[model samples]
Target: MRITVADPAVPDVVALLSEHLADMHATSPAESVHALDVERLRAPHVTFLAARDDAGDLMGVGALAELGDGHAEVKSMRTAHAHRGAGVAAAVLDSLVDAARARGCTRVSLETGTDAYFSAAHRLYERAGFVECGPFAGYGEDPHSRFYTREL
Candidate 1:
């Protein structure tokens, strides 16, 4: 699979991201859902990425959002259902981290749900070297949110 910068507005990309947002909202409280919509992902501060297969099918999508102060946040990470368990999320995550490092970010952080619904995501971040931490990037403490950060 190839991972590269991509536009969130693309049809398939939008569909994937819509699924991501829907899942987030279904699993977390409205106030606790931080996943961005397609328009927000297109903001100038966010760099969206897509992972595609050899046939160019969208395998997954992820994004890096600049948070100033040499820090960045991972956003909108979702592997297509068909590609789950095939390392699609891991590959997309690695690419997002690489993009953060390339932008001179000294640290990368992210927030995921703090519940059984997010168990897989928790494992993914931990395996990627991210450690649990307090909320950052203007986020306040929330019982439903689990924050993590990794030094670049």
Candidate 2:
């Protein structure tokens, strides 16, 4: 798999992102969703990444929000359902963390649903060294979700 920063103009990345957002919404209530839409991902503070197969099929994507000089948040992480359990999510996440650290971020965090549907994500984050934490970046406590963080 090839992982790299994405150009929002690309249609495959856009379609993959749209599918990812829909899946997130499907797994939980809209209020519990924390994904960034394409328009929001175009913001100056966000960095979007795309992972594709050798033949250029979009397999996964994720984004990082630069919170400040040393803080960042992981958002919109997803892998195609057909590619689940193939390490696409982990590859994307590892790359995201490396990029964050290179940008001088000391901490990286994420908000994900607490429902059983998201158990795989919870485990992924934990294995990547993220630990449970109270909301950061002004996110108030929400019973529908859990927050995790790690030193980058």
Candidate 3:
């Protein structure tokens, strides 16, 4: 699979992000769901990426948002359901980390759900070297949110 910067407005990417938002909302309270929509992902501070197969079908999507002060945030990470166990998320995650490093970010942080529905995501971040941390970038104490940070 190939991973590269992509436009979130593309049809397939939009569909994938829509599903991601839906899942986030379904699994968490409205205020706890922080996944960005297509328009937000297109912001100047965010770099959206897509992982595609050899035939060019999108397999997953992830994004990095520059937070200034040598810090960045991971946003909208999701692997297509059919491609979940195939390392799509891992590959996309590594790419996003690399992108963050390239942008001179000294640290990368993310927020995910703190429920059984997010067990896989928790494992993924931990395996990638992210450590649990307090909320950052405007987020406050939230029982349903789990925050993580990794130094680049």
Off by over 4 Å in 1: none
Give the alpha-carbon lDDT of every model: 0.95, 0.90, 0.95
Backbone clash pairs for candidate 2 read none
Q: In model 2, state the lDDT of residue 72.
A: 95
List ranges where model 2 is wrong by over 4 Å. Answer: none
Return whichever of 1 and 2 wins on lDDT: 1
Rank ordering of all candidates by TM-score, starting from the highest: 3, 1, 2
Arranged by lDDT, best first:
3, 1, 2
> lDDT tens digits, residues 1-152, model 3?
99999999999999999899989989999999999999999999999999999999999999999999999999999999889999999999999999999999999999999989899999999999999999999999999999999998
Q: In terms of lDDT, which candidate is strongest?
A: 3
- Give the local distance difference test score of model 2: 0.90
Q: What TM-score do all the candidates reach, one by one?
A: 0.98, 0.94, 0.99
